[model samples]
Target: MKKIALAFLCFLATDSMAQVSQDSTISAKEEIEIIEKDTLFIDMAKYKLTIPNNWKIKAGCTEEQCTANSPQDTLGGFDTYIESINITVNKLSSSSYTAEKYANFSIGYLPKVVKGFKVLEKKRLNSYSYRVTYTGSKNNIEQTWRQYYHVRSSKVYIITFSAQARKYDHYQPIMEPYLASFKFK
Candidate 1:
């Protein structure tokens, strides 16, 4: 009786495992369609980004053009509702600056310059990044901003995502992929 019970339990467990594996199988069409993506490569900067087909790239002042001393370049675009997303690469002149110091210096002046300035999160990402999020009012509208500072070779690549406070969550799904796509060459 003990041998029979043990054999039956083993059979049931094997059947359940087989069922789980069968349920997890992916169809060829699903695999191919879901894996297809559109990507953009910036040859001058030696980085590539993946963007959804619906997003449009807008012409605006890039980082290099905006700052006199910093050698920076910016790529920005908008979604279907015209919400803006931007990535700016700023090549700092000093290699002595650490990610923590840079992040602190960047946010230290925010409260003075921005209304309702609040730092939401500040943490390190690997050895070369300091990710930060803050909220403030811009032009009388509450806005949330997320920034990722990638420090490499005396350069800081700042990727910024901003949206009205209420719409911030709505745009997160899109913004997350855009943020993750940033690469330094």
Candidate 2:
């Protein structure tokens, strides 16, 4: 029985390798499709960002909140996505609030919204700047989230990048740098 299982595994591996070898021959078209991806629109009114031409987004978005995603993501909502980013802007009543305080207050509800929340990293860059990387399961999908908390006077801008846990490493490098491109207008 063990030999049968081993033989089956070896067959599967050989088949997979053959597929990879065959696919490599036509990878140029796939590579061209990827090279064709563009991200030019940088002005989102309140803030500017340079993401993919998917930047010419197709979503149900309002002025205050928006969801951006890669082509692999489903529309109507982001219950499924290989990569996604959510931007939210809010006004605080008190002008003295800091990013750390704001995150503590609002993010308490995350665990309730996410099935298994675990904070990977939380850092306060300064009194007014903070960032957090967390992961959890939601809608039965394991996802990783990286959030930046930017405080400007009484307003706090939250920029969150989320991706499927399995795909996070591959897409994060491509999408994460745009976080620094945000320029308030």
Candidate 3:
């Protein structure tokens, strides 16, 4: 009787553990599904990206234009977007122009034109890719911005992500994947 009782208790514990593990696995899968649901693939003339579905292309801008704006609400007595992503293609002035050089030149120029410009971080993604993060004010509201650059075949692709400064961390997960999904075609 004692041996049978011990075996029954062990079985219950094992079953309970299995249930918890299964629940955890289900939760993880659901999370992945949620993230996948938010993604939208955008194909442009020379590039493509997977952006969040909540973002909409600005009026009069086509998918090929590579400009999208996040949902907006009136904040600080002004109409403004919560975030925006703009992808622009620029013809390289010279064949020798490199992504790193373009990135550095772009960041170096920001302070000259952007109000209250402050560099937060600048890092190279690879030999030919770079990213920069900075903060500035527009219409008296502080904003944070990130720019990722990829140079390919005499064209420079610039992907700029901008959000309210306070919301930058909250939106990083969404933004990072969108930037990562950028591909040159």
TM-score of each: 0.65, 0.68, 0.74
Total clashing pairs for each candidate: 1, 1, 0
After superposition, candidate 2 runs with Cα above 4 Å error = 1-37, 73-82
> What is the C-alpha local distance difference test score of candidate 2?
0.64
lDDT values, one for every candidate: 0.57, 0.64, 0.69
Candidate 1 achieves a global lDDT of 0.57
Candidate 1 is scored at a TM of: 0.65
Residues 1-185, candidate 1: write the lDDT tens digits.
Answer: 53453344334333333321111133545433332533322212444444333333333324332111111112133322234556677777689777767788889987887799999999898788888889988778788888888787887777677777766765555456656666766
* Residue lDDT tens for model 2, 71-123: 54433454455566777889988999889988887569799998889888898
* Residue 110 of model 1, lDDT score: 79
Root mean square deviation (Cα) for candidate 3:
16.5
- Give the per-residue lDDT digits (tens) of candidate 3, residues 29-147: 55456447644555655677766555555444443345766655344556555688898878899988988899879878888767999989888899668888999987788899998
lDDT leader: 3
Off by over 4 Å in 3: 1-32, 62-64, 73-80
Q: Is candidate 2 or candidate 3 better by TM-score?
A: 3
RMSD of 2: 15.5
